[model samples]
Target: MNTPEPLASTVVIKTVNLGRTLMDTEQQPLTILQGINLQINAGDSVAILGSSGAGKSTLLGLLAGLDQASTGEIYLNQQPLTQLNEEQRAQVRQKVGFVFQSFQLLGHLTALDNVMLPLELAGAKDYRKKAQNWLERVGLGHRIKHYPNQLSGGEQQRVAIARAFAGEPVVLFADEPTGNLDQKTGQTIIDLLFKLNRDQGTTLVLVTHDLELAQRCQQRYLLQDQQLILQTPAAVNPVNAEATP
Candidate 1:
């Protein structure tokens, strides 16, 4: 038997004692997440798993700096998110990309233009070429001129993926990238995600309820009872039976 090679030591994202709390309808305190400590290394694929309303998305939002933690600290590429202002955090988010279950493509924009939007905002010299290249890479070359509504669900998701990688982000956060598609189509999207992750060496942090999808990641954490629990391979199979969102 051969031992697998260890992941690189570079930490792209780290959190310490992270927590989030919200007020209930009556204004009483309700805790969504608490005491989360995690370290995601460079070029690693990580998955956050839990039942619906288990604070999985909350954790992802905090990790990506899209939302603030009510307590504790988060370090993104060594920049402290807990200390950054909104504008400063937005600046830090430039190195990140996102894919949503809804696909989140602008309906009015052509696939090509949708992919070009971020690059153009960043003032890339050749946004069109870069967008076209990514579209081609995602096997959407022929449909670049199509609008989101004109494409199939899977096709729209491909464009979304192309848009995400077009910026060459250091980390990609996908919240149920395959949630909208049928099982077969979802599998195709999953394969594309991992291929892009490996080819681009981008760190992947995925939030999903699908056990099979979570299993594909290098590291898996279950968000339950307001805590993050690392799952061993042996433990994953049992979770799969009941894992649902």
Candidate 2:
């Protein structure tokens, strides 16, 4: 695939001819993604729907600067990611946030403390007040003193969400965030997520296998054949898309 032309200033994320290759057990090359060109506008809610091994997470990692691509370039927040070093990338990440399936909370920290970590790292003042407010907003104020182990799976995830949004990030990357919860619990978490997303006007890049969840986003992409194809015109049938492993 060819690199796309420069997008408008509103574009928060843009990838050109992106690809990733890794070595298998025999040291042979395994291409996980190829020629994945994507553009995400600010405040856009986009979902990347694909099978388990379709490189959804991989692509997300590359775009988020958690990992690097083997080929091509990625520009995040209009800054060329490929040109930045690890420290520079870390600085970039400070402007972003993440919610994971495992609910990456600190076991030793209370929910309130966990949510405060990001703000503290960013040298923001009044961290306690801001974190407390976010926790209350997520309906976790009652459990703010509890640690990750003391909370239920849903509560833990809620803390994760609060932590992600407390920083008022420019973008939020969610990777199977609901994968570890039951249907009811997942639905609750999803509701909270979108609520905070809208309230904060944060750009959302969600990777999921759930079609219903994907449909909730404003833009959708079906990742197949190591490429990203837009599911626009509301005519792309996801029912026929390949299943995740």
Report per-prediction Cα RMSD to one decimal.
5.7, 2.7
What is candidate 1's TM-score against the reference?
0.94
Per-candidate local distance difference test: 0.91, 0.88
Q: Summarize candidate 1's per-residue lDDT along 58-80 as a digit string, tens digits.
A: 89899999999999888887678
Report the C-alpha displacement of residue 20, candidate 2, in angstroms. Answer: 0.8
Writing each residue's lDDT as its tens digit, candidate 2 over 18-137 gives 999999999999999999889899999998887778889999999999998899999998777887899999888887899999999999999999999889989989999999999999
Error of 2 at 175 (Å): 0.4
Estimate the lDDT of model 1. 0.91
Which ten residues in a row are the worst by lDDT in model 2? 236-245
Which residue ranges in model 1 land beyond 4 Å of their true spot? 1-9, 243-245
**lDDT assessment of candidate 2:** 0.88
Using all chains and alpha carbons, the TM-scores for the candidates as numbered come to 0.94, 0.93
